[model samples]
Target: MTPSTEMFDPATATIAIVTFNRSNLLSRLLESIERMDPKPGHIVVVDNASVDDTTEVVESFRERLAPSQLVYRRLETNTGGSGGFSEGMRVAYELGSTWIWLMDDDVEVIPDGLAKMGRWAPRFKSIQGRRYDYDGSEFYWQYRIAERMGIPIPFAPAGFDESGYKPMNSGCFEGMFIHRDVVREIGLPDPRFFIYWDDQLYGWLASRKTQSVIVDEFVLRRTREIKQWDMGIRHLNASSNAYRYYIMRNRAIIKRYYRALGVYNPVLFGLGTFMTFCKELIRLIFVERTIRGTSNLLRGIRDGRKIANDRSWQPMPPLATTSGSAPR
Candidate 1:
């Protein structure tokens, strides 16, 4: 059936937010959500073991938003964004949501963002909304990548059409609205990723089976500064040791999955990897000027290579790693 012919209620969806040690931001996010014209049926907050007053903040919102409108799950340990999101999405799905909208605690939804997405939801299984910086400027997220190889094409932007829906190969978690059926098919985001590239992999999985697109609707305002240093050829963001490790280590996993699915390109992947290494090394040596940063990059690369080459590694099933509860 086509989306135009199907019936849907904006309130039937669940908005899942994964957060850690950011109560202030969470408060603002909840405030924004409270103002949504058609509020989501439920708001699932996956607290990644924050030692702060996150619980208290949630309780405060629960009082204002009503306990039934907000559900909180506090993890026993700190799972990075990947794990938090995995658990959050799982819980939201189990709560009988037809759609799950995933995001971090760092963004504020425009009052009508969900309303806008609701208008576009029926047409695509995976619908990604546009993002903007805190200054209200649109974020240029269209980086070019080898379509089949899944590697970035030099000096190119992903072909994005401003007029209509454009097919998406990958997307970020911020303002990403996905159907519950897609989760059942592809599984949850891998917690093993710990942080980087997990969303791209998840998006790729969705794109493989369903129509995924980046809609021109504005949904989120990123509160953080855009982070990127410079690749030898282009500027990218600098990162922490943990981010460096996962990014490098997880590339092999992404490559393996793409190849296993018959879309991997060795030449393109290899070239992308080489370029990434050079750019990161240069960032560490010149921009960052930290030996520790350099060490982390190299270590992450070494670990990533080992993971990529592992013969026994296999993808985990959806919900395989969830440490969260079903919605109430």
Candidate 2:
């Protein structure tokens, strides 16, 4: 489908950045935002109980941006990235932003990125831009849900056609540009996820209402490597056990979400879960070489299965507020 060539006003867009500690990285990202040709109308920073000088960093930028444009919400507790984004999106929606651009503090938005999104955002419900590593290598992030298999498949991007946008089923908060209406429709991201798969599930829900796409335009450069594979596809970046827990546990939640939408295949989902467990087990044993981590992954899978069955698992509170910088 052809996107409208009409230009959209950048002022209608707001940027929502979720940060935890890493004051230096947050400052760098804020500085980059300041340089955008057409800066976002408002920038909401959700501080997830950072022990560092993150609040001080936010205060430093207050002098340059309007009071409303620079908002700082310090959570009383560390709500993880999922909760942080949920609150940030709610605030952005309440502020009457037409669109919300979400990202973490670990990346810097390219100067021309927001401008490009504004130009093309009018044609799609959700837009995701490309990302590169700190060393300037293109990060392979293209992924879609194989509906038949009920699992995500990472595919490499081909040359861009004049079509301008390619449909996508999964999304990441990094450089995610979504219309406010999608937020209203799908509701804010489920904070229960607390870290992983939340954005992907939300993106899938958004795709149900309208089109979502990934544009070839470069929008962000990843400053940190959370996960990476070595030669021969060996796991090189061994993430923390906590991360491993969430990565495995969240699969059940994702499956539940798909089931609610009446789009899930039980047999396929089971196969995918078994394959994931096996793959993680091998990576943990041979690549990471951590038996404890493997056990943690197994525990996560077990608990997640229970979580998926619990009918009383309600969503977390919508908003959490605190005064001053996060506790030390």
Q: Which candidate is the best by lDDT?
A: 2
Tens digits of per-residue lDDT, candidate 1, 265-294, equal 888787777777676676666656675766
Could you tell me the TM-score of candidate 1?
0.87
| Stretches of model 2 off by over 4 angstroms after superposition | 1-7, 66-68, 148-150, 156-158, 225-227, 231-237, 285-287, 313-328
Lowest-lDDT window of 10 residues in candidate 1? 319-328
Model 1 Cα displacement at 73 (Å)? 0.9
Give the whole-model CA lDDT for all candidates, comma-separated: 0.77, 0.78
TM-score of every candidate relative to the true structure: 0.87, 0.88
Instruction: Kindly report which residue stretches of model 1 are placed more than 4 angstroms away from their true locations once superposed.
Output: 1-4, 152-162, 226-235, 282-292, 318-328
lDDT, model 1: 0.77
Q: Provide the clash count, candidate 2.
A: 0
Best by TM-score: 2
